[model samples]
Target chain A: MNPLRIAPTDETPTVNFIPDEGKFEISGNSYPENSTKFYSPVLDWLRRFCAEAKNQKITLDFNFDYFNTSSAKYILEILRILQDCQKNGNECLVRWHYLEEDTDMQEAGEDYRDSIDLNFEFVVREDTL
Target chain B: MTDKQLLYAYNGEMSNPVLNKILSTIQTKLSALGEKRNVVKNVNTILIECCQNLIYHAKDKDTLKEDFFPSVSIYKDAGGYRISTRNVVAGEDAQKLEAYLAKLNAFSPEELKNFYKERLTDGKISAKGGGGLGLLNMIRASKDGKLVYRFDPVNEQYLMFTLSFLM
Candidate 1:
């Protein structure tokens, strides 16, 4: 399958999903003007990826500086897709990265972790942006 | 300079570019002053949600009279940072917003968090692409769950809406 690579913009996040390597990462800020239009394709690609790749090891990293509420919904949807992938026998691990001093981002990670059934590793580090 | 400092202010169209510029300007100023990381993030978050709400819900500039231009500003006072927005909305929308804010103001912090997650997962996103989460997020970030807002009659069909809260 073809990889999905979307470069980050001033108002959106980077999305790099490589099926061959089983590594996906979405990092940076996400507050696009049209969140639905921006996230529709990413959700489609994820569904297709989850269906095709069975019993594989997958790693998804989410490192967000800031995301609006609309983007927050889409992020939850992304995690839900990964939850389905885990249910299909894939060993799925989500690395939730946040700035060491950003309690908002850290709490956001915890909220996403509480909703979905996945192995979530909350990693705190210095700012990388 | 006065203790009540006007850090950043915008008065005009609530376009995406303007919103980004506002956020960027505030981010730079706050970072330069070594503001607390979380406070800066919260301030930006509040600004985005507020401005986006204006972009989606406010009446078209062409339709409104000259004095009703949508505006947003960030300033610092004795209480800390404050973000405020002024916009014009239809009477019906104004009513709905008032009731919604009243309902949100009644929730405890834990209740608000639970409600936010519930809406995030299950609520329908509006035609304008909002899940009706903007005010919720603002109140979530506002100091002590206080979201001060008011509406004044602009005309027979529209109302002037003003919303502000502390960081």
Candidate 2:
């Protein structure tokens, strides 16, 4: 399958989910004018990918500098999908990279981790956003 | 002053640079007025939510090839900023909104945090729209100060929501 790559906009994150490599990353701001319109296709693609995800070691990296409530809602959707994937016998390592200075972003990552019953790691990046 | 007299109006497309500049201006002015850091962040987040609300939910119409926009206001009080938005809303929409805001107004900070976590974990609520957090953020921002809210009926197709957040 072709790699799924979405370009980031002022109000949407860049989504890079490569099934071949078992790596995923979502970064940037996501306060899209209409979040449902922005996130639906991505969610559908993710659903399609996860349905076929087999025996694969998956690593998801989330480095969201800023995401609006709607975007945050979609992130939870992604996390839920990952949780289901993990339940299906796939070893998934979820990594959330946040800017050291942004206490809000760090807290957000932790909040998501807390909600899911999965082994997720939070890493603070210095000087580079 | 009557609410109508106090409203400030801007109608046009919103650019990121313009929004950022306006937000900075609000922040700077509030800071000069002695707003604390926590207060500033809260007010800023609510303001952002309000602006996004204007951009997203406002009824759009193409008349003469221009998109009509919602009228939004930002006012300075002794304690903080207040935001009011005017738009045409259906009765059902208004009723739905009032319930959410009422629930938000009722929650304590600890409860709001728990509510946010529970909502996140459920993942079922997101389908309704992520916009629910707009009210929650307003509540979180104004934990110490009550959100003064009023919804007024206009000439049938319009409802004006005047909401305040004391930072």
Candidate 3:
């Protein structure tokens, strides 16, 4: 399958899903004009990736500076997809990165961690991204 | 009078690009004023939800009179940053929003957090795809988990809904 690469926009995040390297990274801001329109294709790509990359070690990295409520829903959706894949024997780990002083982002990471059954590692960055 | 500074204000049609410009401008302004990084992030997060809520839920701008164009303003005073928005909404929409806000305002922070997670994981996304998380997020991000709002009857068919947040 082809790698899924979406350039970051002022309203959306950078999506870099590399199957060969078993690394999936989504970073930057994500308050798209239309959350569904922006995330549907990305969700589709992830479904396909999970189906094809079974029994593999996957690392998902999420580094978001800001995301709106709508984008928050999509983030949970993305995590649910990963959780399902993990249930199917894929070794999945999530690295949630937030700015050091951003308690909201840190709590957001904690929210996702509490709601999902995946191994989560929180990393704090010293400077703004 | 308290020392109050007006940071940004907009009134008119709202689009994605317009929202981006407003957020970027406010982000820079807040940071330049010596706000901590966390404060800036929280302010921007609340502003995003507020502006997008206006953009997505307000009735079509082309159909509304100029006086009814959605408006948002950010202000800073001794307490903290404050954001307020006003937009014309259908009467039925106003009722639904009022009830939702009342329910949310009644929740403690812990209860609100649990409700947010439950809705996020289980609630169906709205046709517009936000899944009704806008007000909940605003309440969560507000300084004291409170939202002040009112719906003044614009006419029999519509209402001028106003919401304010302090962070």
Candidate 4:
């Protein structure tokens, strides 16, 4: 699988998917002008990558400040893929990193954790930028 | 300047940069008045989505020769910023929008949040259907704040819906 990385802009976030190291990350605000135009490839890559899985421990980190509805949908798709990986006997860990004071992000993370059976770790840190 | 003055100044034609400047100016002013960073950001997102909604779908049959689009207004009241839009849409669409508005009015904060999450689960990452979530986000942003709304008619064929976020 090819390394997937999309840089963040004022309207969207940065996405990094490294299959070789089994490390992935998505961070920033995601309210793109056209959400599908932005997220289709990411979903396709995830779909293809999961079909050809290795027994590596996967660590995916998410540190989004905000996201729109369309972006939110794609995020859940990514999580569902990770959940699939976990169910298939791969060690998948979701590290949901949020700002220290951003209760919304924390609550959102909790919401996802409650609905999904994926093993996730919620961590908070200062905005530190 | 007054809202009518601002609306009249458009003259049915505006350069992209000028219109963007106007939209950005209104957004900046309202965001500053909202005070909270998240609230400001929410307002910014809503206004952008709302304007895009207008640009895409605002249609009026009688005004074939006129600029049949939406009129966005940012004003003040005893409470907070009153951002509004008057877009000419189809009668059927107006009814559908009213249904959505009624649904929004009926939902509590928890209900809105739950609905957003559920839709996030069910829906694909599409732009058109994302309109519903934008409305939900506006509702979420004003959970503890204020949301005032009204509907009016400009001609016999169109309905104008005004949504206000009370700072």
Off by over 4 Å in 3: none
DockQ metric for all predictions: 0.70, 0.28, 0.73, 0.35
Q: Is candidate 2 or candidate 3 better by TM-score?
A: 3
Cα lDDT tens digits, model 4, B77-166, are: 554455665556667777887788778778877787788778768855443435346666666766343456666776777666666564
Per-residue lDDT of A2-120 in model 3, one digit per residue for the tens?
99999998889999999988899999999887889989999999999888777899999999988888788889989999999999899999999988778889998999999999999
lDDT string, candidate 1, B63-114, tens digits: 5566788889888988888888999888888888899889999999999999
Can you give the TM-score per candidate against the true fold? 0.95, 0.77, 0.96, 0.78
Report the Cα lDDT for residue B78, model 2.
52
lDDT of 3 by residue, B46-73 (tens): 8888888887886864546888889999
TM-score of chain B of each: 0.91, 0.69, 0.93, 0.67
Candidate 3, residue B76: CA error in Å? 1.2
Show the lowest summed lDDT stretch of 10 residues, model 3 chain A.
A120-129
Better by TM-score, candidate 4 or 1 = 1
Q: Is model 1 an incorrect, acceptable, medium or high docking prediction? A: medium
Model 1 TM-score on a 0 to 1 scale:
0.95
**Per-residue accuracy of model 2 over B1-167 as CA lDDT, tens digit each:** 22322323455555445455556776686677686654555555566776766555555453212323455567665544566655445557778877877877787778888987776555453333454566666566563735667777753654555566654
lDDT of 2 by residue, A1-29 (tens): 66789998655788899999999988876
Candidate 3: clashing pairs of residues:
none
**Deviation in Å, model 2, residue B38 alpha carbon:** 8.8
Off by over 4 Å in 2: A127-129, B1-44, B60-69, B73-88, B121-131, B143-145
Model 1 lDDT, residue B21, Cα: 86
